[model samples]
Target: MATSTFRVNVLLKEGVLDVQGKAIESSLPELGVSSISNVRVGKLIEFSFDHEGSSLTDEEQTKLTKVCHELFSNPVIESYTLTEVK
Candidate 1:
């Protein structure tokens, strides 16, 4: 078995209010970062999995997706993307 690394990117869905993101965005102007806008806060979760191959199998991906949905992110307000890390 090989150990593979993956990343789960969790972010608030569009139309959902991101209070922390808004707070940081509002403060950026005072800190001289005025050109950036539409800032949103999200979390990156890295995990390792031991599997048979270099890439994740379908079953492994399903398991990870389930974990992301059930543990790492909120279904109503957040969306997530899973990627293999090199």
Candidate 2:
């Protein structure tokens, strides 16, 4: 079996209100950083898979994406992208 690495990046949708980002944005000026306009917070998830080949097949990749969407991310508020690194 070969090994594969997957990287998942999840971020809030555009126009979605991020309270944490807003707070950080508000505090930037107080910290003497006035050039900052806006801020957004997101998450990065990395994991590896053991497969027979160097990478997963297209069907396998699609199944993995479905699993990610159903289990790892909120479809309404968050969007995610998956990449194979190795």
* Best candidate according to TM-score: 1
Estimate the TM-score for candidate 1: 0.91
Model 1 residue 2 lDDT score: 98
- Per-model lDDT: 0.91, 0.84
lDDT of 2 by residue, 1-86 (tens): 87778888988999899888999998998899988876888888898776666657887777788878997789899999988774
TM-scores across all candidates? 0.91, 0.84
Candidate 1 residue runs with Cα over 4 Å from true position: none
Off by over 4 Å in 2: none
lDDT of 1 by residue, 37-61 (tens): 9999999999888888877789987
Worst 10 residues of 1 by lDDT: 47-56
Q: In model 1, which residue pairs have backbone atoms overlapping below 3 Å?
A: none
